[model samples]
Target: MVKSFMTLAVLVLSAAGVYAQDIIQVQGTTPDLYVMHTVKKGETLYSLGRTFSLPIKDIAAENNISADKGLQLGQNIKIPLNGANFSQKADAASGGAPLYHKVEAAETLYRLSLNHNKVPLDNIRKWNNMSGDGLKKDTYVIIGYLKGGSGAVAHTPTPTPAPTPAPAPVNNTPAPAPVNNTPAPVSNNNPAPPIENNTPAPTPAPTPTPAPAETKPVASSGSSFESLYMQQTSNGKNATTEKGPGGWFKSNAAAGKYYALHNTAQRGTIIKVTNPLNGKYIYAKVLETIPQIKGNAGLIIKLSDSALEALGTNDPKFYCELSYEN
Candidate 1:
């Protein structure tokens, strides 16, 4: 079966490279007062930095933001050294492994990684053991964990305020009826405040009919049946000559970095690749099959933006071992 083609390469890297440190450097720019810029619609850290002529790392560090982190539509952030020319260095104080951002509404994991320049989507998923499911907004996943704590997070509830008590009512005696043909004056002493009548208000008019559902990309039945090592065609298509998931494709055939499938998606048996240091296993999921190619022994898979981040690839050419999990 075509499994992780890059597993061997990643193993070699593990032997020689060191885990990156978390730090960013201030570039060649000059500014005193920093403006707190609120992220607007369609705005990213790259675009923001470009607009203000600042380095991406500077803005991220100034605001304690991770590169892969997604910005809310109205979220406020610090704009560092605006209108300055600064170059970004990979191994600066703000260097090291890229930050992992949790998936959010109107955001695909790919979008986050592209904006950050280093973070990969799959690493974020694997780091959090996300089971390849789509990520939700505000869930913690790898972007700037608390200092000095292990990667694992302990769940805790947030505190809420207690409700206020209602005031008691005072008693009053009834007044005698007025004499015939005479109108009684209203009392001014201890007049009760206007009460919000509890009478049921008229039901609001029925809401207008909702608009039609938006259209989305649809893959065919064969698209989900390819083997684990199947690569993608240059035309950006994933077709297989084989009938099922038993065939193979060349490494880097997908053209893109990775292909992501649903965790519940069923296909063929995926090969197991193990990482020796942490004893972590990376499992490949076969969702389709393709024709075997010459010279390529293993299959290269493409990970989506979210998948890369979950797997913890802070830099490009996301290389990792093809290990299996129990």
Candidate 2:
């Protein structure tokens, strides 16, 4: 009886360890840096709030659900990671479970750092035991941990499943015979007479006309986010405007998908960014707040590198005007 009890206890502990390891599966990140979470059985808004260190009401408003409504199992939700709740400081490890960002296609280490509130690039390397800047798609990279969550960060890299080999195509079409374009060789035994042709001096072939130079199309200053901006402010409920110095960061987002990091605008809010120097403008979506780094001090906004180029500026910092719906 004693041996059976000991065996049962070991099995329960092993199961608990497995559960903890699988608890934090990252779905994806929002434009504003919020991580998506799928609701699990027994997870209430109140409990989620406690787990993520966010106010219950904030979570409810973010997902457009009533605070009193219970979360359904497998329902998707977003966990906000603003300055108020998220942290990347080395000391923050003591407070929460590590949060991870699943690397997407063409995502670079530099872009990853900028997306995650500009966490130090070295810190990211240290956390994942990465020896270089390269990252494979679908690899989970630790961005930071939740401030009040449980469990230690398991640094074990998620194994990427090997891709299945595609079947070789079978070709049934026969290949065409090679064309012989060489002229026939003359035989020395049969001396052929040379035929002289006077075809009117070949009409002095007209000088070939030079083709016109190709011109590259100029990139438009317009942004695809413009429609989103218009829709967001169609009601004009919380319109706000500001003009100040703006900074820029590298991004892998497609051209014209301009994005920004502002201190006050809510994530996903579209802001009209205009370069006062040249009157160039673009509508940029706010991702999150400008990271509290030394060089970022005093900047009103941070634009993606593509957004800055669309604005027709090479300057890393420039004066700009912004209009957005609160």
Candidate 3:
């Protein structure tokens, strides 16, 4: 009777979609409250983070796998069954929230505020720790936060439309009425001199073709982005559960030694992307933030074919995790 009752209970649980986390118990005892996941052939840490609704960095830290050391197939990783707690390092204030901004080319305090809804230049300097009115190429400057609301930023530079090529002009300028300059063929053919065979005809050696140039892979800064980003955002980060970076899209528009297209990262920023299935990683420069496209949900970033090849593979698409210096 008891066996039958237990079987019935398990069936009910299964029907209710109650999946227990598979954890490795120490000596038949559960020490840490985390799940141990055996990596699958094509599963990536990015997907795992999305599955658990946790940040990729948190998952990486819990498993002792640095963001640089990508996940590998058949390897077991831990997923912390706890909430993520992130806070800003030096930009938290009591009165208002904080905004994040990346300095572009020739951006100044006045221009930044104007671009960001005219949020006052003095406020921008105070929040971002800026003393002089100078801005660098790719550095982040915290804009003043809004009060009584989440610190979500809103700014979109209008995409420049591509120039349309003009149609070739039709040369209707009347082809100068064809001049009747027909050179007549000579009818008389003088008997050509009898061709003589070369005295010594030796087969010349085949010309050797020059070898193709060897391409050196770009020096990836995967380790640097991983370590630095992790440490910088470790303490006090926004703990909201947003969609994380997933499969890398292939593109050749911004092709380079190490270039990629991201949806949200600032241009010229360095980012670390790990192909979790093979434990391979590469650091790529954000060539541009791709504008949103229809039906592109869950798409994290796009990488150049050459950059993806440097990471490991040249497949059409593959899953990867992203880490950047925020």
Top of the candidates by TM-score: 2
Estimate the lDDT of model 3: 0.51
Cα-based lDDT for every prediction:
0.38, 0.70, 0.51
lDDT of 1 at 308: 42
List model 3 lDDT by residue over 196-308, tens digit each.
23523433443333333332333354454345444544631611122344444433222233556676676665666767667666666665555466545666777756667
Give, for candidate 3, the lowest lDDT window spanning 10 residues: 21-30
What would the TM-scores of all predictions be?
0.23, 0.43, 0.27
Candidate 2 residue spans exceeding 4 A from truth: 1-15, 23-31, 151-326
For residues 1-326, what per-residue lDDT tens digits would candidate 1 score against the true structure?
13465887777566344222211122121234333455666777777666555667887888888977877787777654322432223222132222233345754444443434333444444444444535456443442222221222111111111110111221222233334325434444324544424433533443333433331212111233233433332231432221111112222212223343223233433433222333332334443332244522243443334334334443334334442212
Question: Which of candidates 2 and 3 is the stronger one according to TM-score?
Answer: 2
Query: Model 3 residue 290 lDDT?
Result: 52
Give lDDT: candidate 1, residue 321.
Answer: 43
**What is the per-residue lDDT of model 2 for residues 49-146, given as tens digits with 9 covering 90 to 100?**
87777889999999999999999987888777776667777566666777777778977676677666767656776766665567778667777767
- On lDDT, the candidate that comes out on top is 2
Runs of candidate 1 exceeding 4 Å displacement: 1-102, 144-326
